[model samples]
Target: MECKFLLDDFHVFAVDTIGHPGKSAEVCLSPNNYDYGIWVSDIITALGYDKMLCFGGSFGGGILSKTMCVSPEKIEKAVLLVPAGIKNAPAYKLLNMLFPMIMYWITKKETWLLKCILPMAISEKNIASDTYETAKCSIDHVKIKAGMPSDVNPEDMKNYKASTLVMAAEKDCLFPADLVLPQAKKIIADCTVYLITERGHMHYLTEAEKRMIVDFLHDN
Candidate 1:
């Protein structure tokens, strides 16, 4: 959604991840390894950019993390918001969402959908109109992806050279701040982190935070 800031400031390419639920090829790379990093590295090569400033959130954040490991030199900088791969909460933390999700799938009722997403969003008001629309469409038509990227290996991260900024949500049921930050700071040689206070996995960025992200990525 920060594409507007990126568009205003830099040359941008909005490449959809090849395996995701968008119009991309209907194939998902294994989330357990660095195959996605290899895929992204090839994209950078094909795009003729030796280095890139990257931004991604949630699942995209996981892919970016993989890219940082696969070819660190190719990334000029990075920003990951409410990201996966750095850390993910245990399955038990998410158990509350399962029944609502199943009911939504079976019944296609908006109430069940909202109930399912509220655990992630933290509040009914936190769900954006477009987010709601997108979720509804994706669930109605596409097979939902169940896996988030696995946490990155500290060893694989050792050679990462890009200055990285990770924006973690404090109360996110998945990838909570406590779980993500220590590893981010340890694995990245030049890492900066911002904790989004009182927020969960699906809250919107404040105007100030939006500017901060644009400035961080644009600085290099």
Candidate 2:
């Protein structure tokens, strides 16, 4: 994704999650332990940031949640975008995501499988051709391990002190807004929640949603 919009305003430090596809190390940290938090903290320290505003989406959101629970002092604020770890994904959602992938692997027909999955997984219907191509390439080449991140414990959420903004997609079958929003409000102390009615798990934020996020990051 092109983040020039965000980079134009703020100095963004983006890192590939370890074990995920990217130039980062191939070590996958266990979600059940503090290793993810520690690894992130080490990166922040190395970057010379005493405290930074952190934003994460999907699996990265799970890592951010873990960091908040274990090392809240390292983060000044946080934004979670359709984050995982709030609740386990429903079986149908998993099947919806996995079936197309399996078909693509067996058939080697990336375009057809992506076309089938996009409507079910992503919110945007009119995606750019380049974006679609990039996604297709990544999925075809990337080596990702199977397993969802463990759910964030309620006590951990309660212990996090940083101001947090959790944006949940209403059509997110993976992490339904109905299930995530209420639990987030009940746990995080200074939390703001937005249920994006037009979005799904793979969100495509509207102009207004983008403004809301920018305002929150700057104002809070």
**Could you say which candidate leads in TM-score?**
1
In the range 120-215, model 1's lDDT, one tens digit per residue, is 899987898988898888888887778888998989999997889999999999889998987799889999999999988999788899888889
Model 2 spans with C-alpha error above 4 angstroms: 1-3, 119-131
Looking at model 2, residue 72 earns an lDDT score of 84
Error of 1 at 22 (Å): 1.8
Model 2 agreement with the true structure over 1-220: per-residue lDDT tens digits? 3234577568898998888766888888887666777788888899998889998877788788878877889989888888877774665656666777777888888665675557545634646566677567767787756665667788876667888999888877777889888878887888999998866666467778787778888984
Error of 2 at 130 (Å): 5.0
Report the Cα lDDT for residue 153, model 2: 84
The per-prediction CA RMSD against the true structure, in angstroms, equals 1.3, 2.2
